[model samples]
Target: MTDHTINKAVLRRLLSYALDDPKKLGYAILLLLVASLADVSGPWLIQHFIDHYIARDQYPLDMVAGLALAYVALMLTAAWFRYKQSLQFNQIAISVVQRVRKQLFERMINQPLSAFDYMPTGKLVSRITNDTESIKDFYVFVIGTVLKNVVLIAVMLVVMCLLSPRLAAVVAVLLPVVMAIMVIYQRKSADAYRTMRDLLADINASMSESIQGMSLIQLMRQEQAFSQQFSVLTRRHLASQIGVMKLNGLLLRPLIDFLSGVALLSLVALFGVSGTELIGVGVLYAFISYLGRVTEPLIELTQQLSLLQQAMVASERIFGFIDARQQAYGDDTRPLASGQLACRNVSFSYDGQQSVLDGIDVELPHRGFLALVGHTGSGKSTLASLMMGFYPLTEGELTLDGRPLASLAQSVLREGIAMVQQDPHVLSDTVRENVRLGRAVSDDDIWQALEKVGLAGQIRLYDAGLDTRLGSGEANLSAGQKQLLALARVLVARPKILILDEATANIDSGTEHQIQQALQILRQDMSIVVIAHRLSTIIEADEILVLSRGQIIERGNHPQLLTQQGHYWQMYQLQQAGEHLHKLEESAGVPEAS
Candidate 1:
């Protein structure tokens, strides 16, 4: 029952999309009605040509020629009308798909980061691209096929009645049988199509994961295992596809064709038994022709039942995603006046239990530098996420300048605070566009930002210079270069507060020195927050906080923390020793001086 209601809702939404340009759809339907009328007239014309002249002893060549010409003109007229109607239908379908894809992509991207914690990237992408395409197929194939067949059937039935009411009634009896076949097919195929769509999404998810992690898979020598896993998924998908085909074979073409034969047989038997003076040869001929035409539509309509099922399931999935949690943000749009930030008794949890951060309070003045250090799972990244407004705090106040962080508009906060992640995503767009990020910044500003990050010279060597596009395999830049590009992206914004989540971890020492120098210059104006796995990077910070199990255990400058010999001291000593060992290994890795 719920599925029925959801299907109804999906149909209504599709109807709304079709109705977006009502004038085009209305004209198309009108043309289709005309085409159906013309189509029905063909058999009547043939009946007239047969009984009026050919059956008679007199065959006037002019009249026969006239009938032939009329037949040709009628065929041409129907073809033209159908062609125009199909064009309109296609246009509307494409437009609807474009609009739906835009809305769907907007919804997908606007979701909170936390919402994606449980959702796979590929599954969401499939919803936006693949599922939306299923909707387009409904409009393009199912709607057009069903509407044309229905109009043809309706017109044929009316002509059948015009010829002989009794024979029309016989044909009408077959309507209920066609409907029964349709109902049975729908019942059997609904779950099948739903399963197919899910399996397709799973297949897409698996492919995306494999592609993204192919290097790791190869390095780990798990290629054969991954292939076997993919084979299993594909086999399941194939089984589902074959199941649908079996349904199509059983209930759609073959059974409907058999039913057509049964209808013809029934009509012929009834006509012979009731050999009355009420109907003539012409009438019988027209009835037979109409019966043939009507069954074709019944067959077509039954075939489209599977498509209708697939579209409804796709719609349900799409609406489900759109209705899920959207990132809740405040409407406050006020601009920042200071770089001051403070966290007062802040606590947070992902599942509303077992807090990840608890009772953490800290403050940073304008132009101050603060660093957070911890082992894995110590909430360092979570706190950074909060500072960047990626997720709302679970408890306590995180304020920017003097205002509550959550109350500030995302745009305002984003413009006032910038973060460059360790491995930032570069769009498959030009370098200038990447740095400018759709902002109103000039190319000069982009170049200046790049220059500050010490990547200006390296980027200039590209053939397209600022216009060079980058993504996945197209990016010729190294990992360290991409980090600099990210820093350059943020530098163009010149935010008041900068959060660096180990942004320097991937860079070599020379580039890291350049970035550190850039950060030092920016520290004269902007307050900076750094989350570091490398202890040496934060040794010169104004203050450093050492965290464990969601609470700060030590807070001080580097020298002060060393004196305390606490978690910070232990971590720094370990990193220093590791670096020393790495240098020795590097020395041993090469032959002595020569």
Candidate 2:
């Protein structure tokens, strides 16, 4: 969503999301209002005791005792109400935040691959974590405080008017003027906060990229370059925060001075005009107390206005995500059949300008094996993405068992297809838990998959067996070992269609042999689609598709393609020559691709 759209829809929905919790929210508001009411009566009690009991030179013991008891009872009740409200609001606010966070996370988790392509991971992280916390500030601090001050303001106004309407009139007029200033400041603050959030995300993205590329940076002796870039971003972030702080400072001091000056002026005017003893010392005392209480709301409103402005910016970000076309909703009308896949004039594009797969047509019957061989940037991975429905086809159709893949629900589509990415992601969990992925898999099934991947013996050799935790990035394992673990994860899923993107490319020959054995075991049940750079690996495929640029240049069995002397043939010959030259180099004390 655009920035304008984010502000409009996101802000509205955030308020609604907050209001959804009504029971505890209602009790909390009621308690806060009651506490304010009781506090408001304090000034009146002082006025009554002073005028009728003390200043009248008639200090009756019973009257004094009654007033004292009443004051104590009100204070006690107010204290209890305040306590209850604080607890209730705190709990309710936390729950509301968690609920909104859960919904936001679900939206992101289920988002299509296209979403990730457009939005940066760092920015998305900021929205889910940082933006949600800003909303919490609105809930836990801003909302309750705003309400309490407003009620106190209202009650104080009533009491002030009862004492003298002229003073009350001055106060009421001053409030609107204060509100006007707050509104103007709030708009400016919101804009500043929004810009600050976006800038912060950019800084975070830059830092994250730099850290991930530290090895490359070191290799190129570009550490100074990266450090200078980071320093510039750091300065930008600090400047944005300073701007917000300055805006807040400017608003607070002026509002306080203005409101305090107005109160002082109104008191002076009221004192000067009074003729009767009606507005005497006691009345003046209570008026001063109420006047002080009156400014509490104005001050609170000003402060909350600033926080709410920041929250509005956060809400805009959060709501934009929630309201974004929720990927593409799945069609749950039918279940997936077999794993047969067919593409007819299918085309997809990351950018609208260049198609990743243009006018591609192919057929893979159920339980049939196919290998996609192409030079880098020949839409191999893009084809895998399309097959998995991670990206919707921009034109034409892809079908599974004569049913349009788009028509199948996400759950069903996923149930039918599984992919082992080129660089498989291993979570920070135990080896077994990573494989199960929170699913309740039988021990027998786990062992079967492990054994099929030829990792069962390796797992048994480890001290913790299946329960062994894979350290961060699986840092404890060799690259080949990590690849075997990734294959085991895929094997555990036992999917109908398995797409391996250079699954064994990083593994040693010994590990590759194990993987080959696993594939031989898996081929009977699962249809395998492989995107391989190593032509020798896919030499036994039922059919091979050679892609150039974005279109398929050739498709045939290995022997048939070799006779054609086309792109596939050319790539094979290059591999052959490279292997022969490598063997020669190896005899002369260099490594070779054996």
Candidate 3:
């Protein structure tokens, strides 16, 4: 995006945050206003002390003491007000950052599956954590401190002009030029820093990917190679940081030199051009002292401008995500009356160019079981996803009972369907709580489901039983045990339509048998759509559909397909032949005619 576009977007979103908590903004502005007035009073009080109390032996003890007291009082008041300002502005800063992060998080979750396929998890995380932090710095420092400087400069300039117009005119002339230089520097610095920010996000993405794949790295003996790749990213990150520092160094030094020159020249002219009597020594001293104070705000404004630029970069990334379209969840949802589902002339493709499921037609009557067998890439999972309405079909209609899939609201469809994927996710919580998964299932029901999956005895052996905590990813549970827990969770859900997308493929024989028993119980009350790899598992299925290369090549019962002597029969005979040979070898090994 263009720099102008980036700034405008950031400013718009930042203002929205300010508007969100107007009370904090109002309080911060009020405190700064009070503090600025106190800041402007300092030089006048010092001038009074020098001229009235210290000159010509005219010291009045009571007046001197009172002035000293007033000076201390103003100093204390300014400090108190500054503390209040920090507290109020800090709250505003935190709230705005949190609001932006929350919006970005929600948008990420609700995006279409296609969008997620393209963006990595780590990059999204950087936007929420690192990018939002930049915006927070701008709010607390730039907005809170910079505006106070504007007020202090205005009051000081007016007082200086009243004291001596010629001196004021010289300062006024140099002030705008100094400001113009700072503005140019700010624009350049902003662009450089934004590039640096994006590079840092890329580095984060690479690190996260490497950490998640650490096991594969070890198994392949790629530790050295992976470390080299990581070092490359680290160097790129260091270079970006150095670039930002270099940009600041170039701009800041020149701006400071110009301001310093202005101050020096103004002092020389005041001493040389003004008649000694016209400007008292005390007055001259005050003007010189206040000049130093005035430049402080100018310096602060320029430095804060750099931070504002960084925030602008961060905000663009944040809002770029938040402004994306949220997945459309329609208002109307009609629940399925009988759970009879169909896919009519359906076609789909992940990448639009190649179709995964082509012109397919299929149906499952209520409470019926349909087993699907296919070669590695033969559209089984795609068909299951289409049935769930997670992806819109490229060509044809998917319906539940008599209603179009589009007519059924996504929320309604999700509520009615439950799926057990090959790899199930387990959170860091107790076993019972993980299985409940935010639903309210009774303890009795949970135990009954576990017994059905042959896990009741295992639960009884643990000291905490159902209350025992499982680590994240269920690291505490064995792989087979985790799969059984997944089955039990799904069994308790009792969804009208159960989809097993290779659910039993990742478990041992014992767990697989338990899953079979659970599937048997499920068949009585719910329609089951299973994607299977081992043909023997589906031998007794109501009907089997065999697919190849995104198209169904055969469909029939076990006996009918074997009689046809096609692909299924050939595969079965090969397995039988291997088993018979194994049996003959075992028999020959025994003592002959013992």
Local distance difference test values of all predictions, in order: 0.86, 0.79, 0.78
Model 2 agreement with the true structure over 394-492: per-residue lDDT tens digits: 999998767888888877777778888877777777778877888888778888888877677877887878787777543266666666777777787
| Ten contiguous residues with the weakest lDDT in model 2 | 1-10
TM-score for each predicted model, relative to the true structure: 0.95, 0.93, 0.92
Top TM-score hit: 1
The reply for model 1, stretches above 4 Å from the true place, is 1-6, 471-475, 582-594
lDDT of 3 at 239: 85
> Considering every candidate listed, which one attains the maximal lDDT?
1
Off by over 4 Å in 2: 1-12, 329-337, 473-475, 585-594
| Local accuracy of candidate 3 as per-residue lDDT tens digits, 401-515 | 6678777777777767777777777779988997889888999999998898777888888788888888854338766667678878888877778888887776766767767
**Model 3 global lDDT (CA atoms, 0 to 1):** 0.78
Q: Which ten residues in a row have the lowest lDDT in candidate 3?
A: 1-10
